[model samples]
Target: MVGDSSYGAMSIEELVKFFQTGKVVGFPTDTVYGMGCLLSEDCVAKLRELKKGREKPFAVFVPDVDSAKELVEEFPNYINSLIKKHWPGGLTLIFRAKKGLPPGVVSGEGKIGIRIPDFPPLIEAMKRVGSPVINTSANLPGEVPPVSHKDVRVPLELMLKGDSKGGIPSTVVDVSGERPVIIRMGAVKVFEIEAITGKTILLSEGNVLNILYVCSGNTCRSPIAQYHLSYCARDLPLFIRSCGTLGFSGSPATENAIKVMEEIGVNLTAHRSTPISRELIQWADLILPMEPVHREEVLSLGANPYTILPFYEIIDLEKIPDPIGKDIEFYREVRDLIVKGNRWLEKHLRERFNP
Candidate 1:
């Protein structure tokens, strides 16, 4: 995720050429190691051979949300909420493919699964290649997918220098239907998908709702959101709490935060910060992390990528500054930002919970 992705001994220039020349590359994803070849006719044939008699079609790695719409014929607006919240992660959306796709890349149903991973190094290569790649886990038919490059058994000319602590598979959903069908249950949970689409999720577990708000210290942004949302959340089947990424246990809210909430007629006087925990992650139906780093923290705690809302990414909400040690005016400014962000979140919640 740092600078140039470690693609074995391949240089960036060499890597770009390798992909452009219809060759395959072995790389890692948020979940497991994978091999991908561009949709060029020759490359797809190579991928097909490596894939080895797998009847299912391969998913494509989309560069971003915009490109996803471009590739999918008459993309559905109903799936926008899920795209914004969970694309570029472990959720692969199935869409109707536009004309002129190569032979074996899509299903007989004329659909293709597209996913934008949360990782950057992998995506950068995709951008350079400027076409969708035949993205699938690097494994033969009926075999387990490898989590690390060393474990990959396929004969790959290029290898990305990376190791993975294998996470869950990308959750595949067919959104082309009248109702979204869970094609495959992977990292993203069923309830999280239901929450985004405003549909009811039914599974083995009963539907007790849990919500988590996360930030740096939990004294400012997240706690403010937690207490305010709590007032309106009473009638719903929700359990709400706030936590910090690097917070101390039982820390009190900042004075400026307390004063600003007072002006809004909300209380932050009883707020105390708690560090994020696995128990909390497993309990939550949805997570709203204040920043990107906090999103990573949630993943570390084993929360599904889709379950945690990358709020800053979801709505293009700019950075909400930490006003913990700043002046009263700074605190007020940051408070205003949180208020604005929370307003949008609340509107979405109303439509989701009530509808």
Candidate 2:
């Protein structure tokens, strides 16, 4: 077993040799020690064979969100949103696998668990290696995970000493759903991870809630509210959509509005102006409008069953302002107001929908 010391002190050549040879090395993570091998078909096979473990499945640890994105296929916007809020930390997300990864790694489940450790040594090693590393606990099957290198078994110890730069285990968080659920509570506290991801780590299964926004023209306030709500309701599996009262269909969001949103890191360039329709109104559980008049329009379409909330009421309820032909500065002010309103909406949803 590797001794409890900073393997980070070793030269890069030594670290590279160890990983290339497909040896499982113990490294420190933000939470605990982790055993990993190079993430490739051959290396994965060697690690599994060495562990004498079943093809149950395995996770990969990346150095950052960009790397995770490269590895996973068809990652949804919600997944990107989660990474924006919680990665470069201790959260682990399971996503559909892309073509490059070996099927044995994820056990042909078509999904893979990925993590980005916060520790420097592992991060440096990953950066140097230019790919993900196989992540599993540093222990034999049915054995308790080792808390430190000294706790690793004799055979595993030799590999750690031979190859690992800093064999530390990473804290694991499973985000394969609307909210994260902790399978094992380790180095990172559940609340801490939840705070970053903005999603509660559920202990049991439950329903996912959806929220929608509607207005006359998708260009102005509705789409803005949709994106802002996405940030505020980052914790819930809330579905956010925006449509206009009239079909300008295929029109781009106004340039000034896009500028305002981009300031807060929301890309509205792809937002096409979609008009409000009976089907849309019926599809929504809650239809928030920019003004009271717009709410009436939605209600007239038999959308009355869905609650009609004012943008300010759901977001800042008291500060809804007009944004038509406004200056970039005016749009910025409106954007800030919407962000505040979404915060209020978040609290409301959590209290009302949380089971």
Candidate 3:
């Protein structure tokens, strides 16, 4: 039994030791307390034996985005979108399990609940363990979930003492079908979930032109193109957003880039970086990646939202040159490319909207 200040105090080695030995440990999450075991066939059996509970479906908690991608079969666009928007927090997603997950974990339901909690201790422990851990409420079947370590029963108390520092459980979301359905609302609110999945009133409703722009960094090319398209379509009606294939969230645009755009009366100072997400793809009627490789990266996320090289249909260029750290000449070159691209896009939009 490990006893210390908080679950965050326990070393990764200690947590891995307990999980690898097939012991269930109570841990904190973003919402309430949860019991977890390594998702091995033998571990699953041992967890069931230890709990002496009915054979109901259970969820699993992963360490990070990459780990979640490995456990489930081709994640749908909607699910990917949700993960990007709500992961590393309390949102638990339930999906149809592929062959890899043990049948007992899901109780033969062909579905599995999975989450990536925001807690540092749990993330570190999962990283050491190298697999998704079984995640269910710490309490026995049909009982209220334990909100704190003190609320857990003696047996669970023993398990935590032996293996973990008690932590909270994550909020759960079921995405096993068409739309995301909330199973349990915890730390993450219901409206937050709706914000990501809900449909908005279309301005003109003809085809609802959805556009996504992708580049190396969202700061310059993609965002500029995004705004350019939106500006050109001000008289027309279209849904447009810009993002990067590998951009950080909430980061600001580059200084020189902003300076140049300011000269053009484009206030990109308010633009913040956002990475390409599953939701972005789903929301887009057309995906305009800056290069072929970026187009491939977008496709790898999931299907739909026909990805294309932004200038492929207009010209034969295969890649967009990176304008970072370049002089004014380089910026001018990029601006020229953007202008050409937008001109082509304008024609395309006219065809789609006017025709």
Candidate 4:
């Protein structure tokens, strides 16, 4: 609507032709205006060039439920109920991707976001094209998404006319994992989704807490504690990192530590030691050091007293002694202690975050 009459006046036949030729179009969606082209290697490349430097994976708009079902690897059983209640509205669902989707439409973890929009004109255009199309919000990175046809600034081979609900975007729920996580809350209310799913939706990202675990050599206790809680509380909004007060950076976890963790089903083979620094201390919402001396060391480097706590004190366990250079049996003892402490930590996180 904001463009010159000549450019905005493209017909449906012309729009379909443009899609065939890998050109993008702007159209109104139930939530907002969106710009995209039918999915293809060339089309996705062009779309990526248009939104230069943006890294978030694009969502694809399917014409109907059947198209969406074909796009994902396998639908979760609960998804049928959610679709029955919310499809053709403002909900974008993420599922494990079926193979052969172009990289631009698939997340790094190989998931795809698929939405069946309520907007009739867009649906008609997709049906004509006979495939799903990239449906990213019609704006560049860091810019507000256009709510009306006239607000759209991207160049398009055609601009389809329709009324969007405006203001709020669609709620994005990732069903790719064991538990569904709401990555973005938008037009649909959380309680509404909860009511349909009959389960509490964990918020995956907003207001996340950064937890830093510190030990003498990041090789052992801290990494054990970090990885254990990370796997146990994977659904919570917490970012876990570990470092050592006295250990060298980039050092792998000691062989015993890695072997012992594997016995308990936690992987520590890939962990590299990060030496504690002011930046890390400042980044943490909570810093759990292996012993009182490590806490004292961090405090000397200006960590806030409230944010830094000795692991023993919080878990009500005896101080974790350094197991560096110790035998494999000694390392196993240390790993068990960290595992017990991490169970306490995981409970504390769930109670605090209400996930």
Please give the RMSD to the true structure for each candidate, in Å.
11.3, 17.8, 13.6, 13.3
Kindly list the per-residue Cα lDDT of model 1 for residues 1-355, writing each as its tens digit: 1123455334455556778877788877887788888776676778878888566777888778877887778676667888787777788988898878875767898998889877666676678878767788888877788887778888888877666534568878778765666677676776678868875433222234568988998888888878877765555556788899885789999888899889888889998899989988876768888887888889988887757776565557654567778998988887777666667766666543453
Which residue ranges in model 1 land beyond 4 Å of their true spot? 1-4, 7-11, 201-355
The estimated TM-scores of all candidates read 0.57, 0.49, 0.50, 0.57
Tens-digit per-residue lDDT, 14-35, candidate 4: 5667678777887777788888
> 50-166 in candidate 3: lDDT tens per residue?
557547766778888888777766576755565786787777877777776787766465777778876666687888877788876667666777766667762643334322222
Give the better candidate number (2 or 4) by lDDT: 4
lDDT of 2: 0.67
Where does candidate 4 have its weakest 10-residue lDDT segment?
A: 1-10
Q: What stretches of model 4 exceed 4 Å from their correct place?
A: 1-11, 207-355
User: What are the per-residue Cα lDDT tens digits for candidate 2 across 225-335?
Assistant: 887778666777667889887777988888998888887888888888888888787556567777776777888888643256667565535436778787888888877
- Model 3 whole-model lDDT (C-alpha atoms): 0.67
TM-score of 4: 0.57
Candidate 2 or 4, higher TM-score? 4
